[model samples]
Target: MDAVRNPYTPGTGRKPSALVGRDEVLETWRVALERAERGKTDQPLVLYGLRGVGKTVLLTQLRHDAEKRDWWVVQVEAGADVGLRDLLGEGLYEPLSEIARQGLGRRALRALKTALSFKASYDAGGTWTFGVDLSGASGGGADSGVLRTDLKRIVKDVSLGAREEGVGLAILVDEAQDLSSDELTTLSMVAQAAAQDDWPVLFAVAGLPSLPQTLSEAKSYTERFHYSHIERLSHTDARAAFARPAQEEGAGWSDQALDYVVAESGRYPYFIQQFGQSSWDAAEGPVIEIADARVGVARGQNHLDSGFFRARWDRTTASEKRYLRAMCPGGDTGIGTGEVASRLGKNLNALGPTRAGLIHKGLAYAPDHGIIAFTVPGMESFIGRQPE
Candidate 1:
């Protein structure tokens, strides 16, 4: 089999040849888009999961769904170094530019002007006009220095402008757990305003398992927002995820091979694609067998060890690595911070900086008040394999 035909894409946010096990979430997003066009609003959607579980892929798909409906969509990845105001202002430029043409409706012009004000709020030097005349437009208060006030004004104007064109607006944020508390609070407030006033706008954010908790702490109203917990594929869906792509390319997987790969991959979408690709390459032809799967798993594990796992491992400082080692015998499950500090022969308060550093680096997260766990599945095994 030619490697070129391999349909398994194991990169970040890569859409699989067959996106299995997420039909419900996709359908819900689809319905939300349709309803928005009819002037109905739905709660913001929050997706939470461990790394490689396909939250980013699903968030990207939701963006695609809105795009297909001609909705004004802004998708961005939140980061600790970047503020939400700048990320959003930059994300909106392309969409606003796409519709900034002559003879634009008043609502569109107003939205464009408000967008200019939003941009000015963040970057006083850089500017964008979208090549439209807005001398008489009625939207410019977005320049206010307040995040909540400015964001609300721009979102309202832009969503209303989208409604004038018979569609809705969508804001999708990835890695949302990295956003600051203030940023998160402002977003929640704006989203609540949008929902209460029936603005044609929808927000979908994806992040680690702690995201729901983070949002709840940011604003209690987030309790009412739709939260979807994305996890590893079920056995049946895992089978389909592994088998469908190869089948489409005239390649089939023997039952033993499929079962071996599915189980060995732990049903995680990223691991499935990696093993599927490796297994396909190991196979001689039309059908992949158990032996091929064994070879594939071996090769896939090597790839993950060197690339996926090693990358995160390398990012940790020597001290951070030691801290990670202490958490390992616990392996993937949340471990009490007290125990980790005890294992290191230090007071719990002494390791506070180390624990916070790991969380900030995205390698670990606080699953509960005093519990810490790896954000990436199988990370414990990877750390165990490392030399002292």
Candidate 2:
């Protein structure tokens, strides 16, 4: 098999060749889009899961679906270095520019003016001119310096503009768990306003497993938002994820080989892709054999250890690494903070900073009160392989 023909894509947020086990979500989003166009607004869609489980990939697909329908879609990734206002304001420029023209709809002109205010809210020295005069348009209080007020203004006006085009607006955020409490609360409130007013706007956010809890803590009403917990594929779907791509390339996988890769990959899409790519390269040709699968799994594990897992591992500080080592005894499952502290010969309170540091670094999260677990699958095994 030619390496160039390998269809598996095993990188962060990379869309796999055959996206499987997510039809239910796709269909739900499709219906939501249609409903919005019909003036039936739905709650925001929330996707929470572990790393490498394809949440980002699925979020990207949702963006694509809205893009195909010509929705005013703006996708951003929340990070410590960027505020939600800056992210959304910057992401909106190109879409706003694309629809800007002379004699544009009043609602669009309004949105353009509101967008200018929003931009000024963050960057006072920079501005965007959609090549149109907005001297007569009415809409520009988005620079209020209040997140909720400003966000609602932009979303309301832009969604109205989209409605005039018989479409809707979409805002997709990745790593949503990183957003500050104020940012998250503003988003939830704006989304509620959009739904109540039937503003024809939809929002989708993707993040680690703690995201739902984070959202709920920010605003209790976020409980009403549509939630989907993405996880490993089913055994059947896992098999298809591997087989379908190979078949498309005029290659086939023996049943034994398929089982070997799927089980070894634990039905996780990223590992499946990494191992599948390795298997394709290791095989002699038209059909993948069990022996080739063994070699491929070995090679894939090496790649993961060196790149995927190692990169995250290297981000930890010396204290964080020790804390992570203490966590390995529980494997990938959550361990109580007390237990981890006990293992490290420290008081639970003394380990608070270390525990919080790992969570801050996105290497671990509190799945429940006082219970911490790796955000990445197979992280414990990776730690065990690491020399103390």
Candidate whose lDDT is highest: 2
lDDT of 1 by residue, 129-225 (tens): 6876788888988988999999999999999999999998999999999998888888888988998899999999999998988898985578768
What lDDT does candidate 1 reach at residue 118? 96
Report the error of model 2 at residue 177, Å.
0.4
Model 1 accuracy (lDDT, Cα): 0.92
lDDT per residue (tens digit) for residues 141-161 in model 2: 999998899999999999998
Q: How do the predictions measure up, each by TM-score? A: 0.98, 0.98
Steric clash count of candidate 2: 0
Where in model 2 is the C-alpha error above 4 Å? 101-103
Candidate 2 residue pairs that clash: none
